[model samples]
Target: MAREPQTRAETSSSPLEPRVREALGQRLQELSYSFDEMVLRIPREEMVECCRLLKTTPGLDFKLLRCLSVVDYVDFMEVVYHLSSLSHPHKVTLKARLPAEDLRVPTVTTVWKGADWHEREGHDLFGVLFEGHPDLSPLLLYEGFEGYPGRKSYPMPEQRELYGE
Candidate 1:
């Protein structure tokens, strides 16, 4: 016997998807599914508050901040946060964009304490300013490092020599 095809509703979505949508409401810039996980694009201004809701919301308890990382896109930077729920089988990725000229966003350390070092790392390498971060100290780079090495625009020694910079 042949099996019947499943419709979209018959397929399972990440359990956290609806809860996240309801919690964030119109603040979310975009929402989609990738690799069996829910992805939310949050505005930079709403990042901190969104993160707080993700952690504190009853049904959408994203209590574990798995990782935080930055992506340099030449003209802008994308901050990505991977969060998981300890009490539920759910995970979500949140992204916020920061313009190259203003690489600043409020720290999420208030929501997840583990974000402290991650923010520091972003600040050290991407020149991102995590405002209100307790200590934006060096995580992977030495103090007094000149440019944001993580950015694509960071001139290498050869490039600097070629350009006489």
Candidate 2:
């Protein structure tokens, strides 16, 4: 008999899963869960450890870090990580909140080498610093550029240089 592959929702340990949720709750602080997608809002200090566990845990093997993105809300920034279980058939989203002033989070490159460029891009655009990142140089911006050009407060330079105004 042939078996069917499970959808992410089917195979994934829902954010509400007792075993997974309990394990995370014990290690992390200020944790919150969304009932719908089961996205976890992990504290910035615990993100690296949580990510490592999510990647290594047996039943909750969230090995692949598929996407990384950041949202700047002026007062705070959110770093979102989309993880998938390649060996098994599951997925999870982990979010770490960082203060706008500090803008620092532990590097997850050790857990997933591919985080290199993603962290760089975030640093380039949002000025989010990934502590312990081997290379946090700007990925899309030229070196020596001042201010994070992507921030809302960054002034838009006049076109006088090009227009001769």
Candidate with best TM-score: 1
lDDT, candidate 1, 33-100, per-residue tens: 66566778899999999999889999888999999999887777889999999898888889998887
lDDT of 2 at 126: 85
lDDT, candidate 2, residue 85?
Answer: 81
Best by lDDT: 1
TM-score of each: 0.84, 0.78
Candidate 1, residue 98: lDDT: 87
lDDT of 2 by residue, 1-165 (tens): 222222244334454366567668765543334443456778888888899888887888887899999877677788989888878666667888787679999999999999999999999988999999998877898998888877766777776687886
Q: After superposing candidate 1 on the true structure, give the runs of residues whose Cα lies further than 4 Å from its correct spot.
A: 1-13, 156-165
The lDDT of each candidate is 0.85, 0.78
